[model samples]
Target: MRIRLLGGLEVTSPDDRQVRFTTRKTSLLFAALVLAGRRGHRRDQLSELFWPGRADGQARNSLRQALVDIRRSFPPGEHATTYIDGDQDSVALIVDPDQTDISIFDLKLQSDRPSDLAIAADLYRGEMLAGEALADGMDEWFGPHQNKYEQKAQQLVERLSLALSQPGSPEETACEGLAERLLASDPTAEAAHRALMRIHTLRGHENAALRQFELCKALLKRHLGAEPEAQTTALAASLQAGKAGDLPLTAPKANAATGPKPPAPSVSTPLHDRPSVAVLPFQNLSGDPEQEYFADGIVEDITIALAQFRHLYVIARNSSFTYKGKAVDIKQVGRELGVRYVVEGSVRRTGDRLRIAGQLIDASTGAHLWADRFDGTLADVFDLQDQVAASIVGAITPKVEEAEIERAKRKPTESLDAYDYYLRGLAAFDRTITNRSSLEEALRLFMQAIERDPEFAVAYARAARCYATRKSNGWMIDRAQETGEATRLARRAVELGWDDAIALSYGGYVLGYVSGDLDASAACIERALVLNPHLAAAVGVSSWIKICSGEPEAAIEHASLAMRLSPFDPRLFAWQFNVGLAHFCAGRYDEAAAWAGKSMRHQPNYPSAMRVAAAGLAKAGRIAEAREMVARLCAFDPTLRISNLAEILPPFRRPDDRDRYIEALRIGGLPD
Candidate 1:
């Protein structure tokens, strides 16, 4: 029989048919035995897990019965000893060490080398026993182990991300797919998000990068009742602002916004120009910390919805959230956030009614440009959010003709309720990264949103991206099914919302990562950019693809363009890393070293940066520095050997280029 654990739990007989257990608990028992490795649980422990809260006699009887059923099913003499029961010790899965998928997953994860990542990703089936029941005793017993697997999945994703980020490799397509899977399994996983964002951005899908921020914001709001973690938010902001190069790796001081604000409105500033704006965390005027999420959600939704407008250069949710619960002068806030206009608000909820008061401030003069109060029933909450965003958009950009405002007000697809669910789904998806349960919750919310609005192209695109990412990252078991679903949904997104930059970028990114059609990927990303030049996702993805396709010079240029557009973006590491990779591919060892050094400066222990730096040092004949860098790489991933390095690298379009990179690493002393 073959056991699969990536998608749903499935045991197949030799004939290739699924083997169904009488109860899910039995499957759980088997899974536990397999995951436990050689050391199995004793009878008493098994009883507690299988029949918790029961009397000792009853629990023992239950364990005995379970064993009897398992034995009968196995028919010891006829069946292979997949399960072995000991007299007084424990029960274990009996198999050759190399036969089991779980063993393979463990071996890959335990390896300190980056090459094992691909194998690990392929072995993932799905969320462990995805549709299995976790009632009564099984919940406690399996919960911790599930958590452990989820964490391992995340680690493997990081390893693959590092590998794919290297220069001169064809593995990027596969790695990109794996990263997508990882994100699907844990949408809010910072590493997964960062990896996907980097890949998409390089492929010239800057809008996709921005969508990543949206997803992150949605997940955070749903789960934490808060914004994304500071680092993640900053990363997204940096990408959106096209300032990925300028963003610092460490979290900026929470007490103060990071950089200077955009120039104030003046004679030089066009009247029709919507001075970009950022909505900082509103003061909780109601004196209830519990209401903070509502207040923050209001800001986030407005920010996201407004950002969709082609004319508006709204700051990403991350940079805006830096001011959460902090006090600051409006001019200082504007200056630090790099926006000429600022929107500040307060939320007061009373029973079934909510009172939201907001103002648009001219950062240059600290004058109130527009102020309004929205008083309504709880059901009208989302409408109030729309009104607030629309008002702010109109106030800051006086030339924004009424028609333009109306155009901006156009609902995603005439389904306000679906939009609401989409917002809520985004919230859940953003917070799903810390654990498996959260990921499932996020998926549930996304599915709920999709059901409410089947034609919601952005929603479909995001869902597809999520599932594809989950499979790619080894966070799920059934890679083929998840990716297949992603492909279908992404194609649907294009059919439904061809004009939506986000949909195009996200859908195109999924296509490129999973299917390796460079032409299609390029076309989709280019279309997204033409529709929204300021869309950071489009810019980032385009740059990534250029580098992977052996046009490192173009990659650097694209990254530069993205940085200029979104200067305060928080995800600078991605841009810088791409720049470094491009330089490495172009054989600019010195420049590559500098860029890699810059990346390390931002994210000190970033594995990709470390490898890039090592490669640069090796190419430059700085043997000592190269060796030191390799040592660091090895310490981070001990299983990294020269043979595996070549295997993990993305295929180089040029044989000479590939040979050069491999030789550099070999000289730098990668083992074997």
Candidate 2:
């Protein structure tokens, strides 16, 4: 008896008769069971996987039907002869290890023998579970395994091609077949094109080699709207000049000591006036292709670490990751992103061992200022990433910067899945164009991350931030209930991520603005500044606390610091609004009006910014502009009035400041 799961889910009995399940769900269940092996899956888990969004009883019923169908696909068996062993609570697979093709494939992948390697190569007939699409949420659970199998297939190709690419080997001819097959699946694979060209050049087939280069060029132009990387183009040029031996036939191994390290270029006009950087997504060189997510996560972690540096202006991940799967020139990337430096790297993993190679390049001169390689076990992966980030910072500016080192070393969660969910939440939160749906979705994703890892403090902070975002967007339906929840989440974030400036900043901001706990918010933000010192949003929100305390002069300085820390931060508009409040408090009505109008341009419907804009205009004697802002503010939030301001706003310590705001609002046509 044999079962197949790599390419498609199929079963064959001892008699060699193919067995088919009645439905895709049944096949999926059986495949899941077999993959589980000795570890039993709970009935509730299966029900949720197969019938999500259905009523509990209905989901359970559907799972039972799928299980029955799966059991029936077994050979005409008597009692206790089934592959699946199940009680009411859980189900397990009882099949022999040799009876499953995927089990054999895994064994071959782990084995060292060339014979076993060849066997693994033969087993991958096509994409894992070809033509398969699971239920909506099931895809997330299923994708990693699919990637795992696909990675195995790629490893088989690379290993075999390399081994056979050498002279006079019996397996040499198989290299061409493998390269062509890989290219057919992923035509944009520049490496595969190079491999084919190298194979032809090795055999002295110059015509074939030239044809391969032409094919690569056409495919790259048509599909990616670009040319090949410098190495590929150089290889083609060398081959065309009949200097095939000069071409780099083997892939460049990332060795920190041996490779041609770019010398640090002389500093002229620095990348920008301020230290600026773009971090490209690290290439996944981990033979197990499924580890691409881990590579991506590393880049994200490094980006966050770099962003925390107040001295360095970092491009957002959205802008940098746009280069993924594209052939890019470093100078072009610098020009497009307006950055001086670029950090690029590759990640490799073998069993428990891990290797990360990183390079910090001056994008202007394409000169590497620094390059390093880290070797460690899987458990030390985060520490390695931290080292890389800390190293880059030290290379960029070797100052009195222990605080920057500490800032770069913070870890949000130990669980990679939790980190992935948190990133999804961040993406959702980033798109809140004053809409309720995106914020709601962000909350859901953050909640999922929390469910995956309860101690994920950053997720809790982000979840809290969602409520604050809703409040800011005038989308809060139950202010009291939401304020309590927001306060609770923020407290948890501070408790858990005690040293994380990101968590603390979010916690402090929500506490100040949404909970209106001026003292607590001020204290938390002050502590956060001590922790990171460069946290822009924290400084901005700290100014809000100062505004409430009626220290207009101090508030103005903090607001300016916030804007300087991150001029492009979406929340910088609120920081600008705080500056307007400071100006309005100091009787500088003209400056207040200008800053208020600037805030209004960024966040058109922000009730508070709008109120300040209207009030500032009225106080400046701009009656026509004041009336327009007043009308817009009333239309944006009709329920807002003078009496409710006390409950909604942080209390002003100075009576004159409070009176002045109310008087201006009243003059601007806001109801008293």
Query: Which residue pairs come into collision in candidate 2?
Result: none
Q: TM-scores, in order shown?
A: 0.37, 0.44
Computed on alpha carbons, the lDDT of every model, listed in order, comes to 0.65, 0.70
lDDT of 1 by residue, 1-672 (tens): 677766567676545666776666777777777677666666667777787889968988877776776665554555564656566535665655565676687777656455676777767655676777788667666765666566566656655654554433444555566667766776657657766665666666778877877886777556434455444555676677786543323233342345543333343432223437777776554435676777777777667655765445678878777566443556566666666777787776656666776766656545444455667776776676665554444343332222233333464645446555555555554432324465566566667768877888888877776764454323555656766777888888878867877788878877776655556777888888877565665687788778767888899998877665443343466678789878989989978878887776544556667778888889998999899998987876666777756423544466666777778878888878
Tally clashes: model 1: 86
Q: Where does the lowest 10-residue lDDT sum fall in candidate 1?
A: 399-408
Where is model 1 more than 4 Å wrong at Cα? 1-448, 463-486, 600-607, 623-652, 655-659, 662-672
1-672: candidate 2 lDDT, tens digit per residue: 788886677688666789877888887878788877877687777887888889879998998887777666663356434466778767787788888887898887665455566676666666666667777877766765776566556555555544443555444445455556567677966666776777777787878888998999888667645556544665677788788774433322223533332222244334443458889878765546566777787788778766775446888888777666443556667777777778887776656877776767666655444555667787876776665554444333322122222222353445446656666676666654465787788899899989988988777888998887767556678878998999999889888877767787888777777777777777788887776665666677788888888889999999987776555566767889999989999999888888886775665566777878788889889988888888888887777777766655556778999888888988988787
Local error of candidate 2 at residue 663 (angstroms): 1.7
Q: At residue 92, give the lDDT of candidate 1.
A: 66
